[model samples]
Target: MYLAIATDGVELQQPERTNELYASYWERLGPDEITKLLAEHDAGELLPDFNHVMVPVATLRRLAAGRVPEGWDDDFAAMLAHAREKGWLSEDGEAVRAHLERER
Candidate 1:
């Protein structure tokens, strides 16, 4: 959720906006690095500007099919937790699944 803060004459308020902002970061980093990056972001130390994030279909398929790379399960679990926390999973999971199935 994107919080729009408005200040008017000594009053700071958050305005309700119809649009929400969401972002994701995916890279080829090792598991430890990925965990560190997610930790930094979760601690509000990093802010990335992104909208709809996607992984390569092939990679996603492999992941969904239980063929993860070495040490990827933990990273994937963290990603899932993040997505669920942001409410993006409910909104996008079906579409992503469909896309992956189609790519098979």
Candidate 2:
């Protein structure tokens, strides 16, 4: 699944006024990385890094279909909620940024 990692304390507005302030670091996690993420999450090691992780809605759906990795519980839920509330989640939950007016 793909994610759009965001930078903190940054805001760049687009003409459409969609608040495209957050610069996204697009990533598609391999199995090993996904495993590590789950491990870190379970161990409470991901709190400091949680804000950077912006799981797309599609990825969220994929995760829902597959069983959540063992040990991912309240913490994961909280982060997902935060991502959604913070507008980090992509509209369709896909990492498509072609329409965003990125700052070069």
Candidate 3:
């Protein structure tokens, strides 16, 4: 089950039986037997690659806290240009001005 501990000090747990299958499978195999089996299969590529670009959770929290880093203005300008090219932003001056004001 998925679990989450919120920053506001709330603890949450998923009430589900998804882990039952895994529990039964492990029980039937026994811990030591499964350990041996895993050791034998360790020579083969059994896991998928998890290579991915990601920002740190802490860094995201800091950014959300309005702690803008150096060069943020340049980055934001570039992002705005890209968004404009993608037609996500309105072309009118008043709309653009209002959007920028709300962002700050």
Best by lDDT: 2
Candidate 1 accuracy as TM-score = 0.28
The TM-scores, one per candidate, come to: 0.28, 0.25, 0.28
lDDT of 1 by residue, 1-104 (tens): 12111121111011121122222233334334433543433211122322223322233333234333455556655555565576645454531111111001
How does model 1 fare in lDDT? 0.31
The local lDDT score (0 to 100) that residue 38 gets in candidate 1 is 31
Where in model 2 is the C-alpha error above 4 Å? 1-71, 93-104
Q: Scored by CA lDDT, what does every candidate get? A: 0.31, 0.35, 0.27
- Model 2 agreement with the true structure over 1-104: per-residue lDDT tens digits: 22222222121222122222232333444434533653443211122333333323343334344454444445445544565576654575443222221223
Please give the clash total of every predicted structure, in order.
0, 3, 0
Question: Model 3 residue 29 lDDT?
Answer: 40
**Candidate 1 residue 19 C-alpha distance from true site, Å:** 24
TM-score for candidate 3: 0.28
Clashing pairs in 1: none
